[model samples]
Target chain A: MSATLEKGVNAFREVMDAPIASFFNSCVHCGLCADACLFHTETGDPKYTPIYKLEPLKKIWKQEYTLLGKLASMVGLSQPVTDAELEEWSPLVYDSCTLCGRCTVMCPVGNDITYMVRKMREGMAASGHAPAGVIEATRKTIEQGSPMGILPKTFLAQVRDQSEETGIEIPVDQAGADYLVIMSSMEIMGYPEFLGSLARIFKQAGVSWTVSSEAFEATNSGIQIGVSDIARQIVMRIVDAAEKLGVKYVISPECGHAYTALRWDGPNLIGRPYKFGVVHVLELLDQLHKAGRLKTEGKTDEPLTLHDPCQIVRRGGVVAEPRNLLNMVASDFREMEDCGSYNWCCGGGGGVSANHRAEELRFKSFQVKKRQIEGTGVGLMVTACANCRNVLEEGLEHYHMDTKMIGITELVAEYLKEDKPA
Target chain B: MSHMDLLIWARGTGLQLALGVFVAGMVLRFFEIYSLGRKPDLSTPRPGKAWAGWKTIVSRSFPHPSMAKRTYPTVVLGYIFHIGFFVALLFFAPHIRLFRETAGFGWPALPTPLVDAMALAAIIGLLMTLGYRLYHPVKRFLSNFDDYLAWTLTLLPLLTGYMAFHHLLLPYTLMLAVHILSVELLLVFLPFTKLVHVGTIFVSRWYNGDMLGHKGARL
Candidate 1:
């Protein structure tokens, strides 16, 4: 079946639990969350306030769960959450909100407004109110192996090209490798240099890793679209590939939500612990650096800044690893005002980048990030997430700014110390 | 009823009923929230950040440093309001006596003038809060009947308590009764409205902090 309002309402009921109940109950309409959200702050639009985006979900919670709400419904004192409301809220739920979690941390009552937005998307997606672009992306993710509809052949071709370019054999489906490396479609299509960078770094570190033909796509449109089952299908591919190959760890590429989906949410989505571990590329690189296996010749002389991907640093908890690795490669790295876990979003996360309708608002909200970059006065900006890199590049280009961008992995690879221990 | 009878009722049956509803309603609301229960996080948690949940419960009381300028009315004024309200509620001589009689123990009360100042500060903070709510676009847009109702119920107790203490609004017996009645109104509605946050905020903080902290993100 496609979708129905009943299904949407049922999905809302299914997702509702203690944390959400507490969050909804604890909200005092202080509106401080708006200040924490770039969408509201940049646009000065009250509708973009974080918690208000969940009005439909909150209504369902109130109508179905609360005693007063039940009585109100019975007496017709309160209107039920209608299909039209969900339809109207599509842009707010999917387009404007980026699941950045800035509002989650800033809520005075600790409401976790971003958490509710993630949950609210479940209803929105099930109700068929998800934006066309996102729905298409999810469809492509399920039908093809990737959201961008890049096939395994295309991925292997890119791997082969990178292998030739780097003079390193990019292993595919190699059994008994120490790590099963994954890549998001953005890195595959937009920045295939990442594969070359990873190959060089892993080779230098003496790491045995392979790209799985079945699970090379790291970004999960299912998670972006808020469907657990689809997310599970996407994650299970990696788990299966890892288990089949007996890889000890799975490397999440420089994609923000991809790391979160694999590291934190994968087991829960699949309802079982993975046989192998999940590590972000930065975490693995930092480990190699600390172990003295990974070394860089010299730091970049230019003053540069790092943009912390919300999912990778804040939500994924790979906070120190980026800084640890960046310290080795960047000499004059300046910190943003709220860098590391409290960093502002690139306005392109949580399927907003995938949604065509969100482009205008997304660009408008990029003002906060632009100010952050300008404040640092850094000509070069480094980030670990490919999605952030893409979004930040778009923002910079749209504003006609000349700030150069690089992935931390690629930046580190440029300075890789090639000589082996004698 | 005469003012004396009203005062007697407010102290005796009215206080008892309010206290009863407050306790029972809170218990029920807490059940409504906690009983829903969350799923266990099947993801491997990062070690060494176990206390982050409790830490955030206390830490979240302060505004994020970068956001402090923008959140002055909510955070700074919010602190003033909460501190003043709590001092008046918990430390005033009559309140302490009442607590001692009911709970079998009481701390030494604050100086009357200090408690009075705090209450005055809280009243001012609350008025400022009202002004902020009206003026701030986001808050104004988000505010509903329940928000304003909770605000009124909260302010009435503080306003009426101050009036009763000063014997300014009405005859002393009538004002005290009204004060007690205002508090009783707050008590009865506390569990149903956003005022329930007084209890649920801790739960919210814990859930948020624990989830993030489990992933090794300090909230």
Candidate 2:
């Protein structure tokens, strides 16, 4: 066994132990998945076909991975896999595909191609087949608790700018607050204004809230890099912090993947659903609108469109909330026909946007987005996810597509009614 | 087209066309897949876990979002083409009754109208999907001659089967000869080309699901 392989064969055995794997024991590929892939779409590469992408795992499963799989493997007819084969598969698996779940969405039978890629990544990561960039990122996240390795004080320093700019008096662990706001590391580094906006929005709405310095970040770069223990450790750190603080609810900042890591999987990974409710900033904003606690005074007339971050809209189902907020602030909103949970990735999700080598793949993947933007005939774009903002800004710069990028919260903050504190 | 004369003519001419399409198509597709082998993506996953990585294939095959998150159409439509297609190839009265002379047991089949409708739908679906393979910019760009050949081979058999069954323009024996020849071609090509995807897709999907679900990645 490779040193990077899971210490025992037990991890492989545990998969069949679950009926989900057994349930998956059945399939006859019609190549329906090819139609749904970003890589296939962007590159017109059939090799990126979702069905073809699964050959490595299939060969192993058929031969040594499962009971029936082994019997099939023994037959001369069984699929085969080799280390050299893995070396070749790395780019197709990592650089070409984004694990964005578009294929999963389009799959006729609900096959999750993204997940398959994730497992392939795990196998690769475990076997030390990970790309140099991914390995480095995973190592950093494992040690630093965030991909960037920004210290807790540095994180606070980033937020301090928000406090100074808005004079919103952002509180940290003010005991007995009704809400605990979870923020992502992206916000800490790039958009401190968002933290100020969250404070301003909440204070105007007459809500009590506190931020956690420990577990301050909601982003799990480990998940992005395909490191499970690193991912779990990140989630557990936040949940432990949430419990220690004893807050009523955890309202996530305007970040897409982080929201999923916390609300959707955090519960299960932490061995239980969180005691407090978990939701995104858009959800909170939506609640404020429904409760008549939020008010907007201005609108941007620039022709604009919305880009739904894949994780937030597609995976987390936080689609309309962002649209509803954007529409409230702007009169001219043209949705890319494929907008909503089905919107294509900005080529930034799944950590691809972060890897230096993946820049070209990122460019190809963003072609769909570029077409969407061009088709919209819009001048400005709004999205809830920071990673989407990073990618769109970077992609536009690279592609020389002239467009403006704005966050939903920052937009909402601009439109907030000027009034006395509620 | 006299009774015996038509049968003999069909056996000779029709079988030749069917075999030519099937064998040539398979050979062309095998080469296409061989070209695709140049792709490094196929070789990315680790080796020697004692089983095939089937996580992604199984999960995506059911409850897809584009299908309105529906399961029935995928299940019913998928099984009919795969299960029914194979059964018809291996067990239809003409194939099975004849095969019994060599190897086999009889199985129930649909009524004439139903079988006719199924064969027709399968042919149309098969061809339409094939045409789509050629037309779709992504599929077209990714396609090799092998891809085209694979589509041709899979569709022709279904088409010939339909024509043979319909027998509006051709005699039954003539059509049946074509159908059987096409089936034999498909059987021979089963391990090569994208046709193999029809088998690989399931295991691939399951592996995908297992990987994502394990990592808490949204599937």
Candidate 3:
């Protein structure tokens, strides 16, 4: 019932489907993934090599699946995956790697190294090798409905504050709404202005939307901790909330993993398609702008660059939506090199920011983003994901840089055209 | 046995045994990979997106422009080694003759000198790659017995083949027998080692592409 090495091995067995089998078999160990990863590039440590991080998984595959490997095991030529080995590898599996998909794109043999890491975390979590911070986050997500342990009452209070500030009555559990807006714990706690921004924009755009009193938490700590059952439970709350409200779409808040959890992984996790469509908040804004439902009066002349979140841009495929929204609001937008889908991670994705033990390494890896920001020579940076914004802020503060960050949705709302609307 | 006898055996029984292991091993390896069927993606794919998997199959072969600076040498050398190896294997006159005899088909062969040049290039590329693997921190950390074994297995045939063609290292009959035997050894081991990537690379690329493509990511 609880964590064990056998259970971990069994989880590994369960996760090893055809693609994984093919990937393990196809790897030539070219080490090109190392160059693609910021952790490896910044640290100059070969242990951070993406494929090397999957050594545990690769060992399991070889021992369990291959003929030569089977023969080797029978003859005592190979060792079984042990608890000590798993403990030793916990940091490599969870701390250093961010599941950014950059290494996945760069693999010469096309091995999806990030996918393997995501799957490998399942085994790590089961075997009691997962980082304590992420596990605690998962526990909080289940017990308090937020990774930050934000209770429903606290979320409602923030909602009330935002509604009062914006002078818009933020709907709560309103059935027959056109959309259901979900917020990650970070957006609710660290950046409540996103709520106000959404309210102002939707009021002007003439859209019908509501926040779920029952399922306001959008981030999935189960995903961060690598437990599918818990992830499915988290997704079902939003699904239930949306279906009960009979909304047409669910808007994922300005969070990277939240969008990935809600839009891409949610259906598969719950084993069914949702009654309502899921859209990133940026995507909805882009759609509203393109359809002429949303209008902007002015563009900011201050030069700024965009930080593309790995999960939302590369993994979730909401690439163009942010660019579309940013162009409408900014006159001096400079793109970082490898902008859009190929942009570097904030070094805090995939629970690295959530895992306190990884703080030093995460800051070290932030050097890549620092160089990227410096390359743009922009004092201001706009990003779509609240988690990325928080991480970027901390990185800038740690490095004592004066670079500033704002969420793209809030930036767009700052330029909203003033007009008469009910 | 005499060099003549060794050459006869390499051209006869050694060829059959190598071919048999190569075929059976590949089938078993493919079965191992494909048998564990994956779950179908249940989520609605991004609508109106082209099949990016097919594009990725061709596109991934070229270094991503953003990654080109960091990866140029490795990718370029990888291409030279693979392309040169294949060119020498399939385009050499003697190789085509052997293919015609075994495969019941033939393609036009490049001139002997051209094939020789390709063989030399392949040898140089592989040597540089081996050096890179030894010198590069990540590659050195990743290398194991299998990587070294695969490398040696691959390089032996090219070295022996070139020597046999030039009659440089040994008597023609002995060198030819050594070349055929080295090629046979490579064939026998191909499906068991990382060299199996020669076939599974396409499958791996397709899966990566398809998963990302389903999300409408331009891989």
Instruction: Please rank every candidate by TM-score, starting with the best.
Output: 1, 3, 2
Query: Residue A102 of candidate 3: its Cα lDDT?
Result: 96
Q: Supply the TM-score for candidate 2.
A: 0.72
Instruction: Note the DockQ of each predicted structure.
Output: 0.88, 0.09, 0.82
* Candidate 1, residue A280: how far the Cα is off, in Å: 0.7
Q: Is candidate 1 or candidate 2 better by TM-score?
A: 1
The DockQ-derived docking category for candidate 1 is: high
lDDT of 1 at A163: 94
- Candidate maximizing DockQ: 1
Give the per-residue lDDT of model 1 (tens digit) for B1-219: 999999999999999999899999999888989889999999899985588888889999988887888777688889999999999998999999988988899899999999999999999999999999999888889999998899899999999999989989599889999999999999999999999999999999988899889888868
Estimated TM-score for each candidate: 0.99, 0.72, 0.98
State the fraction of real interface contacts model 1 keeps: 0.89
| lDDT tens digits by residue: candidate 2, A323-398 | 8898899989899966775678787777776677778878877888888899999889998888788888988988
| CAPRI quality of model 3 | high
Which 10-residue span in candidate 2 chain A carries the lowest summed lDDT? A14-23
